[model samples]
Target: MKKTTLLLAGLLLVSQLGMAEMKKDVKFTEKTYGVCSREMSVEVVDGKIASFSAVRGCPGNLNALSKLLPGMEVERVIDLLDDNYCSGAPLAGYTSCMDNLVEMLKYHVMGEGEGHIQEIRKNQKAGRKVVAFNGHICSGCGLCNAQLS
Candidate 1:
C-alpha cells in the first residue's frame, strides 16, 4: 500500500511539472505600410513561431513565408527579415512586406526596438508617409523631418 501511494504521488508531481513547463501561445496582429500586404498575424509558442499569415500581399512569396516562418525562433526571424527591400514599387518607401513583418515581430512579439511601430501607425492614420529603418525614423530624407522635430 505504501509503495502504491508513493507511485501515485510521483505521478502527480510529474504532471504538475509538465504543466509548469508548458508555455502559452501568444497571438499578434499588425497593419503594414509601404508594402503590398495590408496586415499580418503571428502566433508564437515557446518563443518560436507557431504560425504566420499575411493579408493582401504577394501570394506566392507570402505563402512561402507563412510556411517557412513557423517553428523558427522569433529573434531569428527578425534577424533574417530585417532590412528587406522592394524596389519595384517606388511608393514602398524602401520597405518590403518582409521588413514590415520584422518590425511587427520586434515591436509586438519580442517587445524590443524603439516605438517605430506606433509612429508608423500614427502616420498611417494621418494619411502620411513614414520611412523607418532599424527602429528609427529615417533621417536620410527630409520628408518626415517635421515629425522628428
Candidate 2:
C-alpha cells in the first residue's frame, strides 16, 4: 500500500510539473487557406516546444486560444480543404456568402492569428471558377451562385 501511494504521488507531481511547463508568452503564427484557420503556437518546453494538434476554425475564440497558447507549443496549422472539396462546389455558398465578410475575416486574421478564412470566386465566362486562399484561387467548383448570395 505504501509503495502504491508513493507511485501515485510521483505521478501526480509529474503531471503538475508538465502542466506548469506550458508558457503564457508563447508566440503563434496564423495562416488562412481554404476556409481553415492554421495557427502555429510556439513555446519553449524543456528547451523546445512540444508538438500539438493542428488548428481548425476558431470562431470568436481568439482570446481563449491566445491565452492557452502562451505556454503550449503548436508545431503546425493546416487547412483541410483540398482540390476535390472545392471542385464539387461544396464551399460555393460559403464563398459567396463570405464576400461581404472578407473584410471581417481579414481583420480577424490580421489582428489576431486565431481562425480560418475562406474565399470563393466564380467566372462563367472563363469556364472556370476557383475557391482560393487570399488572392490565389485554386480548385474549381460547379456553379452555386445562389448559395453565395
Candidate 3:
C-alpha cells in the first residue's frame, strides 16, 4: 500500500496538466516544532507541488524529500508522508515532514474544517483512532496518544 501510494504520488507529481500550467500558484509556510525539521515552505501550482524548501533539518533526507515532493499532488503527498518519522524511528515524540505537511494542508491547501480529514476528526472524536502505517511496521510508540500536542 505504501509503495502504491508513493507510486501514485510520484505519477501525480509529474502530471501533464500540472506541468502545463505553472502560473497559478499558492504559497504556504508552515512552522514545525518539537522535531528536527523546524520549518517548511511549500508552493503549489495547478494542485501539484512545484517547489519545496525546509529549514534546519537533515540535509540528505530533506533534500531527497524536496526533490521527490515537487510534481506530486498535495493530497497524495500527505497520504505518503502522513505517518512518516524522522529516520523512520520515534524521535522527539513529534511529527516528521509528512505529518507536518498534512497539518499545513489540512488548514491551508484543503481549507479549515473541510474535506475527508474532517471525517477523520469526527471519527477520532467518536473514539476512533486515525492511523497511517508504513505498511504496518509499528514503531511501538503511541501514535494515537491523545496526550500528545
Best by TM-score: 1
User: For every model shown, what is its TM-score relative to the native structure?
Assistant: 0.60, 0.23, 0.54
Q: Which sequence of candidate numbers ranks them by lDDT, best first?
A: 1, 3, 2
lDDT of 2 by residue, 84-145 (tens): 23222234434321221232222232232223342333232244544444454445454432
Instruction: Extract clashing residue pairs from model 3.
Output: 13-71, 13-72
lDDT of 1 by residue, 52-135 (tens): 998987899999989999999887887898877777432344567887777777666655555445544444445555545446
Name the lDDT value of residue 60 in candidate 3.
89
Candidates 1 and 3 compared: the better one by TM-score is 1
Error of 3 at 42 (Å): 0.4
Worst 10 residues of 2 by lDDT: 75-84
Q: For each candidate, what is the lDDT?
A: 0.69, 0.36, 0.61
- TM-score rank, highest first? 1, 3, 2
What are the per-model C-alpha RMSD values against the true structure? 10.8, 14.3, 12.4
- In model 2, the Cα lDDT at residue 41 comes to 33
